[model samples]
Target: MTDEAGSAGALTATAGGGRWPDLREVPFKPRAPWFNGDLQTIRNFLVVEGLGRGPAPPASRRMELPLNDGTGDRLLADYSQGEEGRGLIVLIHGLSGCSASAYMKASAAAFDAAGYSTLRLNLRGAGPSAGLSSDCYHSGRTEDLANALRTLQDQDDRIFQRGLCLVGYSLGGNMLLKFLAEYAGDFPVTAAATVCAPIDLAAASRWFDRRRNRIYQRRLLNWMLRDAVRLPLSSTQRDAIMAARTVYGFDEVFTAPRFGFESADDYYAKSSARRFLSGIETPSLLVEAQDDPWVPTASYDNVDWSVLPRLHRLSAEGGGHVGFHDNASRVPWHDRRILSFFEWVAG
Candidate 1:
C-alpha cells in the first residue's frame, strides 16, 4: 500500500477515547524464538544491523543546541529535512544510548520514509555530545529540551504549523513525560509517546539491581561509568562513578550529589515522571510490557490512569523491554503504533 494510504489506515485505527488498535482486534504476538520476554529483549543485539530498518534517512546535517543553563553545555542532533507537510519528529534515546542507537536509527529511518522530518537528539554528553557539557543530564533536565525547541522555533517557524511530535525510549521516555508535564502549554506539541519508560525511578532502580537482572544491570552501569569519565569532572567525581558496582550506587555517588539531591533515593523521588503525569495536557501514549525485566510492572501500575485523561496506556501482555517484535512484521510494534497515533493527532 502507498504511504498515504497506510497513514490513513493508522489514523482510523484508533478507537473511541483515542486508544490505538483496540487490543482485542490487534494483539501483539511475539515472533518465534522470541516468544518470551528475555529472548525478545536480547534479539536486537543478536540480529544483524539494518536487517529490518527502513530506508536510509535522507541526507542529514548536524545541529548543536546550547543549553540555556549558562554552563556552555550543548546537545547534538541529526536533522533530516523530509517531504513538506509531514511535520517533524524529535526522538530521544534510552540510558547510555544516543542518536546512533539501533532503535533510534531504525525509528528515524521509518519516520523519514513516511515523509516526516526527523531529529535524533543526543542527550547531554551522549553520542557526539560527549564532553560538550560539564553538567550531567538527569530525568528532570527539561530545560535542555525547552532550549532546543525554542531554538528550533526561532530558526524555522514551520514547526508550529506542521506540528511537533516527541518520541522517547526507556530513560528518555521518563524524561519526555516529565517535560510534557512540567512544560505543558509551553510548546506546540501535537503528540508524544514513550516506549518502556521507567516512570518510577526508585522502583525501576530497585528492580534493575535484583539478582535476576544482574547481567543487564552490570552492562548498563559499565556504559554509564565509561561515558561519565569522558566528561570534564573532578578526580573525586571520576572515582565515585568508576568504583560504583550498580546503577543505584553510581547514581548515589555521582548523579545525586552532582545534581544537588540529598541521596539516590531523593534523586529518584524527585526525578521520576510518575509525580508529573497528572500535569500532562498533551495527547500522550505510554507503552509497556507486562514482563519487562528491568522495570517492574508495579512501576506502571502505580500511576492512577483515571486522573490523566490525556494519557493512553498500552500495557501489552508481552514484547519485553523496548522489544515488541510481533509475529506479523520485522519492525517493532510500537513504531507502527506511535506513527499511527501521530497521524491521528495531526489529522
Candidate 2:
C-alpha cells in the first residue's frame, strides 16, 4: 500500500515468469481521502463527479460487427477519431455499462490524446443493441469477446503490425482477463489492463451481500434482474428466476445454466482470473483499490503473481470501485496510473 517502498519490488517478487523493466523509480503518491475521510461521502462525490458533468470528446463513428447469433444483433464498436496513430486500443465496460458510459468515454478521450485509435465495445444487449438480442451478456461470456478481438485483428492486419491494447473496467476486466487466459498464444494482444475488477466473483457476491454493500448490491442486482426478466426464456427458466432471492441466487439460477455451467460455483471457478494469472503471456497490469467497497483486497490476494511474470498487480490504498477521484479538483488517479503503465509497457 505504501508507494515509498516501490511497487516494482512487490511485482518482481510475486511475478516469476514475465520480465518487467524496473519501475521502482516511478514516483507515485497515494491520494488522500476527501470529505472527512468518510468513504460514503467520497463515494457520493465521485458518483456525481464521474457520472456528472465533464469534458466531452469529439464526434464518434459507430460501426456494427456482425455476429452469428442469428438474432441479428451485431456488436457495436464506437471509434473516436484521432490524429493518425499506429496502435488500436479497445475499451470494454463493466457490468451494465456500455460504450457510452462515462468511464469508457473518458478512456476513449485519453487514448485519442495519446495518438491511438480507440474502439469502445458495447457488449451484447448493453446500449443501443439491448433490443437486438433477447439473451443478455454475463461476466463469464468470453466467446463474443474473443470473436470481437479476432474481428478487429482481421479488419486491420496492421493491428498485429502496430500493437493491440485492451482496457477493461470492472466486470469487463474480469472478462478480458479470462479471455486472455483462454487464448494466451492464440491472440495478438500486446498488452492489457483491468481496472477495479471483481476477480473473485463468488467473494464479490458475498461481499455485496453485506450490510454496507447493500445499496450497491441492490442497484446492480436490480439492473441485472431487469435485464434477465426481459430475456425470452422457457417457463422453467422464468420459474427459477422468479424464485431467486439475491443476485447470487439469480446468477446461479439463470446465468450459470445458460452459460453451460452447473451453478454459481462452477461459473465462478471458470470465470475467475486469479487461477489463470499464472498463464497470462501478454504484458498486463491489474489495478485494484484496497478500499474498493465492491471488490475487496482479499479477492486480489487470491492471485498468484509469481507464475505469470508479465503481469503487475497494482493495489492502491484509496480508490473506490472505479471511483479513484483524487483531491478537490476530482482528477482521476486511476486514469493517470493506467496511462503511465501503458506508456511504460509500450516504451
Residue 202 CA error for candidate 2 (Å)?
1.2
- Which segments of candidate 1 are over 4 A away from where they belong? 1-24, 48-58
lDDT of 2 at 140: 68
Model 2, which residues run further than 4 Å from truth? Answer: 1-51, 69-72, 156-160, 328-331
Specify the highest-TM-score model's number.
1
Clashing pairs for predicted structure model 1, backbone only: none
RMSD of 2: 4.2
- RMSD (CA, angstroms), candidate 1: 2.8
**lDDT by residue (tens digit), candidate 1, 124-181:** 8887988577755777777888887887787777766788899999999999999998
